[model samples]
Target: MTDSMLKIENLHAEVEGKEILKGIDLEIRPGEVHAIMGPNGSGKSTLSYVLSGREGYEITRGSVSFKGKDLLALEPEERAGEGLFLAFQYPVEIPGVPNTTFLREAVNAVREYRGEERYDALKFMKFVRAKLKELGMADEFLKRAVNVGFSGGEKKRNEVLQMACLDPSLAVLDETDSGLDIDALKAVAEGVNALRGPERSFLLITHYQRLLGYIVPDRVHVLSRGRIVETGGPELAEKLEAEGYAAYVGEPEAA
Candidate 1:
């Protein structure tokens, strides 16, 4: 058994009394990329939100542990402080906050939490510039408002930049591939792949296996009806790519 970085066992959750995730069990260890593929409304985003300690979700049963610490016990910021990052499917627009300011605050906050010295402004800007280069992005993006008036691909790339800055141990990327052109998708995949290492892990929540063609998960899990119905190696994703989810998704066909 591999030592787990994030473990969710039989997790059941709801929002406003409407059950979303039902009995979700997954384990991700360091250096492993685990892809969760399902149709829309299969509770994919819900799982990411719940794991990140987002508000409005109720966990009715089961448990989640990150690095052997009780995940449910941490507040959202606390979770981030502990090196758990969740990249949202839809990046929110912070109208008044410049992307640089938001990222600097976030990076320094996590650093402070970990008892590390904060970066000086110049040092931080240099750090961010290098990350952008790695992601095939330019420096002009740092001057814009966070997700405000940015293109879809830019927003997703910003999310990747944040991931690079924070260097989280576990990254839960919810629909990171949505709305990207082939080039943008490959860039995002390359960013993710660049971050892969023996001490890092990822939970890639996506609807299609196309992104898998780039990142290539170590394991592929089929989620249906709020539960994981099947799991296999990377070949499973190739199979799903060819056959589509209908042949395997046991849930009542998504309405």
Candidate 2:
């Protein structure tokens, strides 16, 4: 069998002197979609940040291996160059940079990192236009600043569009379904599903199971108190929806 695309062992992390992720171990092979379901303060976002080399978090122990490379040793930009992508819970606004410029820069950066040539103006515009058409977005979107004055659903859709264009090996979506209505949720889910492939994988971090109904996961792991309490198949999400996180993490207040 091929090696695991992402191997995380004994991972521990802290934020502002408070420990958030403790002893997390997970291995996601290629093409597998793994979901991390938990209540509030379960360290789901912490794990994502630690993997993506985000600032302000301290990893006191453990190692993360991405495609057999030392993930933690690299800087955040280096991690992005290595085909790791993180879709934030709240997509930040870039007031001045147009969405087209941001997407081209991101794609070109990754290509340049891998020793590939950057896309010229003609090629980039044509390519990005196809992507927008695929997602049912108008050309007007390319003129708007990134996430500036975008509604919650539009921001999430933009994130999905970015993921499609970048085509990362692994995508970590943190609470992507938050604040989205059912129609927007399904639209985003369809975009995500369209990108699924053998050479790619996904790590979905969510507080609710509704997203799972649209994008079924291969495995579901319940996180509580900075640790993964239980790992199961898609049915685990159903159980979480039915029974809640009480069994594994005690009461909601405790978390």
Candidate 3:
């Protein structure tokens, strides 16, 4: 198998007839945690949306290969089946649907797509309970409606829980630390740290460096005007925090 978990080459995307991403070239290897940091309107969220197969964005050029397959060619569900999981910036609430029920259906659907057998309710609960416990979540959470009454912290933790249960190969977390307190941030970070391994990779997009203090990504990329203008180690995040993105903004596009 290829060592690359995800590969993007000269990727350009447009939303509603306006360009958002321009020539984004990124490669994420297995077991690497890469963070993308940029100011608002820098196409950070746009890149995440395009990767997750969300609607309204059109890919005008370039290619995205995940696990050696054409990522853009697959539907969103197919991408999920291929072990690509996207943790949304704003997790939506599903009224009336129990968290456990929602997760069970999602897990089973992915399993079916991968040609794996489905788990019954009893077995599914047993499996998910273990994950929830590891994430320091209470069993009561499973009984509540999905994010219906959850606090901001709870919602973020719930996203981490979903990531744990799904066991995705590549997890794209978009601004997961937004609106979270220190305690809640630590909780979410703990869950993420627990899941890191040689078989898994992460793509974290955030506007601040505070989140990097907890997760400590392997590499950091600077996105400006829809392009990745700089790439470096974790120290890059610290520098950006101090110096700000002024240097990168309004610069000429990379050749």
Top candidate by lDDT: 3
Each candidate: RMSD? 2.3, 2.0, 1.1
Candidate 3 per-residue lDDT, tens place, 1-255, comes to 999999999999999999999899999999999999999999999999999999999999999999999999999999999999998899999999999999999999999999999999999999999998898889999999999989999999999999998889999999999999999999999999999999999999999999999999999999999899999999999999999998988576654
Q: Write the per-residue lDDT of candidate 1 for residues 1-255, one digit (tens) a residue.
A: 348899999999999999999899999998899999988878999999999999999999999999999999999999999999998889999999999999999999999999999998998998888988887888889999999998888888889899999999999999999999998898888989999999999999999888999998999999887988899999998888888888656546452
- What is the Cα-based TM-score of model 2? 0.96
Position 139, candidate 3: lDDT: 98
lDDT of 2 by residue, 148-227 (tens): 99999999999999988887899999999999999999999998998899989999999999999999999999999888
Worst 10 residues of 1 by lDDT: 246-255
Q: Estimate each model's TM-score.
A: 0.95, 0.96, 0.98
* lDDT (0 to 1) per candidate: 0.91, 0.91, 0.95
Better of 1 and 3 by lDDT: 3
Number of the candidate with higher TM-score, 1 or 2: 2
* Candidate 2 structure lDDT: 0.91
TM-score of 3: 0.98
